[model samples]
Target: MSIICKYTIFYLSKPLNITTSSEAMLNQVRSVHNVRPPRMKYPLWYLQRERAKDDQQLTEDNRAFVKEAVHDKFGMPAVIHGISTYDVRSALREKSVEYENVEWSPKFQRTGLIARKLGNYPMWLNNGKSVLTTLLHVIDNHVIKYIPPGEFDPPRKPYSCPNHKKNLGCLLVGAESADPQYFTKQYCGLFYKEGMMPKKHLGRFLISPEAALQPGTPLMASHFNPGDFIDVRGKTIDRGFQGVMKRHGFHGMPATHGVTKSHRRGGNVGHGGEKGRIFPGTKMPGHMGNRYRIHKGAEILRINHKFNIIWIKGVASPGETNSIVYLYDTLLPLRKYKSSPPFPTSKVVEDDQLIDSYSEKMYKFTNQTITYEEEK
Candidate 1:
């Protein structure tokens, strides 16, 4: 055995003097193994702009000062439990400001709101048809900053038209005020100009220059009217590693048959001949959900100004309950707004007397029961 091992080592140690064509093939295999996947491109603004959480260490006094500053600006913190607190609500309520009157036009686009999906419920129409509706609560949303077309620069240009690059602007919106201590100093600094606390979520909206709003402007559910069609975008629920039956809805093999251990397995993914490898997008067991999806042209069935909640027509809005979603004007030509909407955002009315606004086709509980008349 020792003699055989010595002969094998000697033979393996010797270098092979192969032809140029064979050497080229070996080099090609090495190149294939060393090749790297291409990096994905993203917008400049998509890059992480804030430092890691708690990166800025502060003294006890400094932390207290920051909280106190926020309290002073937003008003005294409330201790009540069941009901919504007044302090935060009051802080979000900004005085209405008059800007140059700009008429709504087909070419103009406005900023979107960041709202939380409050779950779904069934609602009856005037015609007695039951429809499932999703409730979206618009949180304390405020405009943090606005970058004009000339000043706004993205890593990859979104438009091929030079005019579009010059005409479109970026709006930075923030929602759900959070404690300053939980966020880094750089993240908190973003709200400094608006005299607001750090937000739980931040979103960027692209709008025409004409629809640009001032920093600190409040966005409400009233921005969209009942009966208006809008688009919703949200992240779907993360359904981790799942089977073919659950992920792709594939029917499993018969349980009664003499199917060995391949009952739930996805059978035969590849071909026998030239197409030997499994094809991309072949349905198989893998990670599911947790994707950004858009549900377009959902009608606004109702709007509650008091709570800043809007009831969307369908329960098909992506994401699990309590997840944040973006609401924007629909881009569908047929469902697009025919009448004028608020130029920038709805005005912050001091007297929120109008609690609920319902669509014409919706059945209002306050109204009397429907009755049928005899044929004439």
Candidate 2:
């Protein structure tokens, strides 16, 4: 009877067209439960797959061909005889190339930058009032790739407004220098095409096709000017597995009275009749923080070109010290200016030009004491 029961159970659980061997059957069962097979070197498909036709294969013969292709694509005109890197750059700047002139529009959008939080400090205003400011250091930032709107296929629509078109170009930007040797072949290949180092962080920014910038173009702190407002976004510091009182800021039961052992406990989660169970999303003790947050309309207090740092007006910028944060122009209605922003991006001409750029209201630390004169 026991043997019959076991046979019936096995037959009922058997799937169609599977191998009859016990070992194969057991493996199939494990796979159904998403269990990793033993001795598997690569878990993801790309980690172990063969290279595609468009991708340059990692072979000696292919290396020279790939290099030649890259040279042809990005090579300067041979008409300029014997030009070095510096000479080419200088010559290009000296020569004025005809570009479709675009009028400045307040509605035009601009690119953004990724920066690291460099701590905060109090700064005295011109009015003698002190305010805390957060310093953001723009790291090594460069353009990686530009995909035109016609070629760029976004997974989902970014806006629901009927006036706006769904098609938008994408700019691949990277920041924070990193050694290529430490990254995977595919990961390193991304920066190789752009002639840049393997970046520590990479992000895609949607932009108009006209705002496209060629790969290898460098970005600097001057991308945002002082007095302009921006939005900073980053992951907040994580405080894992917190209680209701700490996470939700719930006041605990009174210390005295009949509170007893339930001082810190959340009393009476749900009622006893029709609605007995606790509802979903009810604030309870759970994982806290480590969520993406944005600080909008943060005024740019100053910019230091020497150190590539931007001092923002508020100390409430998301992320902890040394953590990455993204800065984009403010979208707030009152703060949003229709005036054209640095189209595409702001170009850093000479480092000396902006040793330290500050807003009019900001009081420079190096400046002398402030005094108010009585009106006659």
List clash counts for every candidate, in order.
0, 1
lDDT of candidates 1 onward, in order? 0.78, 0.70
Off by over 4 Å in 1: 1-66, 78-99, 156-166
Q: What does candidate 2's lDDT look like per residue over 1-376, in tens digits? A: 6564445446744553333454444555543554434543321112312233364457987776765654444443232111122111211121121223456566556667888899999988888889899999887677777776666656543345533444666777787654343467787777665565556777677766666666766778888888889999999989999988999899979999766888888777887788999988888889988999999999998988877899998888888899999888888988886566666677757645558989899999899898888999
Clashes of 2: 1
Q: In candidate 2, which residue pairs clash?
A: 106-338
Q: What's the lDDT of the predicted structure labeled candidate 2?
A: 0.70
* Per-model TM against the reference: 0.78, 0.71
- Provide the lowest-lDDT 10-residue window in model 2: 81-90
User: What is the TM-score of candidate 1?
Assistant: 0.78
Best by TM-score: 1
Candidate 1: minimum summed lDDT over ten consecutive residues — where? 79-88
